[model samples]
Target chain A: MGEAPLSWPDGNDRVPYWIYTDQGNYERELEKIFYGPVWNYVGLECEIPNPGDFKRTQIGDQSIIVVRDAEGGVNALVNRCAHRGVKICEQDKGSFSEIMCPYHQWTYDLKGNLQGVPFHRGVKGNGGMPADFSMADNGLDVLKVHVRNGGIFATMSDKTPPFETYMGNRILGYYDRELDGRSLSLLGHSRQRIGANWKLMLENIKDTHHASLLHVFFVTFGLFRVDNDSRVEMDDTGLHTALSSIRGKQELNDGTAQMRSFDSNLALNDPSLLDVVREFDGDQTVVMQTLWPNVILQQQSNTLATRQIVPKGPNSFELHWTFFGYEDDDEEMTARRLRQANLMGPAGLVSMDDGQILERTQEGILAHPNEQGVVELGGRGTDDADHMVTEVALRAFYKGYRNVMGL
Target chain B: MTITPELRSEIADLANAYALAIDDGELDRWPRFFASDCLYKIIAKENFDSGLPLGLLMCDSQGMLQDRMEAFSKLNVFGPRSWRHMLGAVYTTGSEKEISARTNFVIFETLAGKDTHILCAGEYRDIIIREHGALKFRERLCVYDTTMIPNSIVRPI
Candidate 1:
């Protein structure tokens, strides 16, 4: 089939629209991108800290079990039985010596090697004539795995770029500053489904300009003001970008529009929720890194998480927002973090309204598939393209996507 | 075990009134169901087991709960829809003034001419208290049995 043309505003040819909706494009992504030479974020090191620890995870629709073996070495193996294609690791995550499939009781070690198959040797030595059937030949597929600063990554393809090279200097710097050897803690998780294309989901997040206007909760609470000066730095690769901004503090007596009501008295009611205010430099900025294709690295409003987008069907996608904090946080701090988590989850004050809007936006797309969205928010010129609030970042995403898809 | 007739009647009335207020979209009246200092959390059973603090809806203090109601009615945008909540079997335990009651409920929502289907099936773990002359909820944890919510749980379940 022929590709659909994409027309940019200023006569610059955009990538084909089929990249967003076509089935053929999805198949190519599965092969060349997801299963290709890209490093995918699996989970945090804190998730499986001890020996016999494990977590069932997916790498591009392929089920792979990530386990820290008895020797404390992390390993990832495809969750499939070699015998009849049944899943070898059935459970989501738990400690186990070996996985025993219920279908035929075929057992496999944590390394995903065939340990034993019940009745394989033949009962009473009367039957079973396959002498050459070796268990060694039938084992789970293992992928090369690595860890960087407590972050776990896996790649299906052997020729993947080094983890450091793939992440680039910009991304590594952010991780170095933010993570900073702190013991990672598992705060909680929130999942929501938005009825828009997966790319749009990533775009909506990394595009920092929407916070002031799109997210009313931010405006109401005085967490971030719209007039803040921020910059969107497009990575050298164009796939990732950094959004940095310091929202000035709202003067209590200025009578400026703040979050909730004008009465500062109500803000003091829940001291833990909206207790402190800080200068623009001290303002915690959200650095969003779109790790091409599926994973989105998000740091915003004291909330750190990696939003894993899994497209279930054409109409919708599932977003698993796993929140994390430093493990050494005190009980009070943890509670405060949990209370503050309401800023971006499904029920988050800022995010609760987003899902509904996204669903409706996609629904509206049905009316005009041929028509395209205008991405001239930052500027028209490509040279001065580093602005916080523009759809130019989306254009950068499409650049990386097209390169990956060979469009 | 002698089921107290008075306790059962009061709990039943509270459950019915709670569902009616929410489904009818009575924003201000819903807060009357809870105490001034209350904990209202509606979380999935999956998240609870995982030790995650996240909730489909987490509200501490009637003010936060009231804040959500305000957002729903005034700030947050949603489609034109109506919900019919079917509250079933109220099991009350503890003293008359301050008791713990659990009730099973199924909330049905309809939008854009679509009929109401079961959105979520959960139990309301309520900590009831008598403040002055009225019965108010000190804590209401809407614990949902189903982990995978239907489509998008936009409205409160």
Candidate 2:
């Protein structure tokens, strides 16, 4: 068998299918994107609020442990045991005074320092270390941790810029608007394994054109119509984007007629599902923001949630959704958010179509590996667009992706 | 009051009917198995046990259930699949006015040319009441053991 020729198109407008299907590219992404100068979302600081509370998570394929120290500071450490490289913590979340390896009982403090070695000095001075093994030298690999508005982020690279500098003022403004000084309470969690490449999932989140076309529930129920006032904004680097739309009275226009889901007679028996309580004080009913690598902050109506995309392999990824509400929310406000939660999830009414669509998309591309996907709907560049029905966000993603992978 | 075999059989039949209705793609008939003001939710057992109120599908009223059925039938796009619901031993207590029953269930899925796979396994904690001369569910909580849902769950389990 001969080796297949690999080629990348000239610009961000064309994406080769092999990127999603090639094993070599996936491995390269793990190093260049995941392990490079990028701040990865680990978990929420509120998740480990109390002292000694910890949660196990991942950055790329490397397992990580996020815990609260005795001084109420958050720390992130590699979950591998320094001796034999065994996983130190196996449970998802717990409260522990110290992280003790169940295999050989190599104890580590919450800061991931090697505290004790069970058989050190050979238990009877027979077969342990030769008197020169320092416990301080065997501490677990720890990553730099940063927390902003209760959101925890970590990076393996010391060269990565500060969190604020990396996000820029525009993206930081959006984050502050959603979760600036407000305290968060975890309402629940839902995990879904999407049968597509991880990038495809992120692209779907950045896509605003598909909302009115693929998701009939969104347009039919008057949540977001094609004629609604909307825009797609991106940061100066084009690595981050937010597709925002405000609810307006539905009216028939050229754009509405072009959509396949523009049915005026469709009605919902339970209209309360579409009720917006105006919690954010902004008129935007939907705001889907995606950070470069894998973090998404969504404000759909009054429902607030953050999604972290973790790649399982080249062909699949796991989406971890953490739904939240304000700490000062009354019973009625919380109930409203909970009720609106039905609009987004693995089985969400307006968002469930994405899972199947992405799967089928990967399947379609796999059938023709030599072909390229045309992302020229908005234009041939990664600049910000003023209309929602544009593919500029996808172009922006490819731009950032190529910049990182050097493809 | 002591539970009678007649009431037990009636409740079992109601459970079976609900399962068959969903499995047979008669989703329009799903709302008929519940009362007007009812709660039907499919939640992870971990969340349910931890007092987390999140659910895969949370319908607070029969109207919401009807809306879900309509959306699944008319709006959602998914592959061709069929569900097979298997019910375990059902235990019922309480009087005829308001009966409580607990039973286990395993739902299997057969996609278009694929082998049948277990979709979800859970226990149903139901509150049944007599309404309009028939037993109906006032609240049905489907607590699943599987936390990570495969792809998407478009159908009721």
Candidate 3:
């Protein structure tokens, strides 16, 4: 059978609505984009610090288990029994001696190697005559793991380049700045299921202009406005991006005066939420690094987190947010991070609007599947920008999407 | 001080009034339930059990509580919706200054034109103290069993 037809609107500016609504297109994305040669961000190495510690997570639509082996090495294994195809690992996170299937009693080691079978020599040799069942050949599907500093990324295809190469030199510089060799402590997590395409949230982070326009807290407080010193960057493939900005004062300036959302009278009743303890070696108060295919490393004020995108289907996805800080951070800094976190997550003062907008965005698009949304804020180009007023990153993302999906 | 019937009744009234203020969209009155300096956190039961210090909403002061309600009412953008909070039995114990209380909560949200559904199911763990003849929450920890949020908890649950 021939491939189902997928149409791409002319130029890099017009994004077709069908890309988000078509089930067939979504399945193609699962194959060509997620499970393809691209590197997918899984979790952090600090999460499973001890041997036998494991966490269940998703990449695309597949259930994956990231576990720490006895040798302190991390493994990303497909959470399916090799013999019976049972979905194992009920707990979201736990410590285990070995991975086991409760149904058939098929067992695997922490490294996902098949270690035991319920009846390898079935029924006291009555039915185990032709025993060519090889345990070595029946291990859980192991993903190629890349451990960088404390970040964990895995790939399904062997064609994936080295982690650094995949991130590119420019994006890697931005990544290392935040994930800088320091030991990290798991602060906590906020998991929410958003009724929008996974890519929409990625677009939200890469959207340099929306911070001030959509989030009143950002515009009124001058945390991320168009007037601030900000820039947008992209890698060679136009897949990876880093958006950074230096927070400005709350005073209404020429750039913010035009925003309808900005209200000068608004102020944080408790100013502690905006307390910025400059621990990182940079002046930028916020740096959102969006690694293609899965995650966004966020450094907003003192709060820090990694937002992982797990696509549920065509029009929905689960966002697993792991908030973290430096391991050696003082109690005050930790407190500051937690307090500042009120600005994000599901009920976050700023990010709460993002979920609503994305859901509405998809709803509106679903109403007219054949139509297209314009990504022409900056222009009809896909170049990095020194200003936030452009949608070049969004355009770049679609350009990469078009190439990967072969649309 | 001991667990008396009068004090238990007063605590129950406070809990009812608190939920009413939020469910009824009388958000301005939400902050009045707490002391001037307080700790109000809506935490996940999983995180609370693991002793992880994180919550969906963490307000450590009266000002922060006001900040949240103000954001919800004025700045934040969300779907037009209303919620009904059905609280379970309110249990209370007393001390010299602080009264410890716990109550189970189940909230059903009704978005405009949508079917009403359970938003979250949780238990409230509160430490109440009297300030100027009125009982107020000094530390209110809302640990929810439903960790996977439905879209977003727009109206504070």
DockQ of 2: 0.78
**DockQ of each candidate's interface versus the true one?**
0.45, 0.78, 0.80
Put the candidates in DockQ order, highest first: 3, 2, 1
Give a tens-digit lDDT track for model 3, residues A280-379.
7778988999999999998999899999999888889888888999889999999999999899888898899999899999888876777888889988
Task: List residue ranges in candidate 1 displaced over 4 A.
Answer: A1-17, A224-226, A250-271, A276-283, A380-387, B1-3, B113-117, B150-152
TM-score-wise, the better of 1 and 3 is 3
Between which residue pairs do clashes occur in model 3? none
Worst 10 residues of 3 chain B by lDDT: B147-156
Better of 2 and 3 by lDDT: 3
Candidate 3 deviant stretches above 4 angstroms: A1-5, B94-96
Candidate 1 local lDDT, A69-159, one digit each (tens): 8877888888888878887676666677777777888888878788887777789986653889888988788888988767778899989
Model 2, C-alpha of A35: deviation from truth (Å): 1.4
Residue A21, model 3: Cα distance from true site in angstroms = 0.5
TM-score of each: 0.89, 0.97, 0.97
Q: Candidate 1 at B116: error in angstroms?
A: 4.3
Most DockQ-accurate candidate: 3
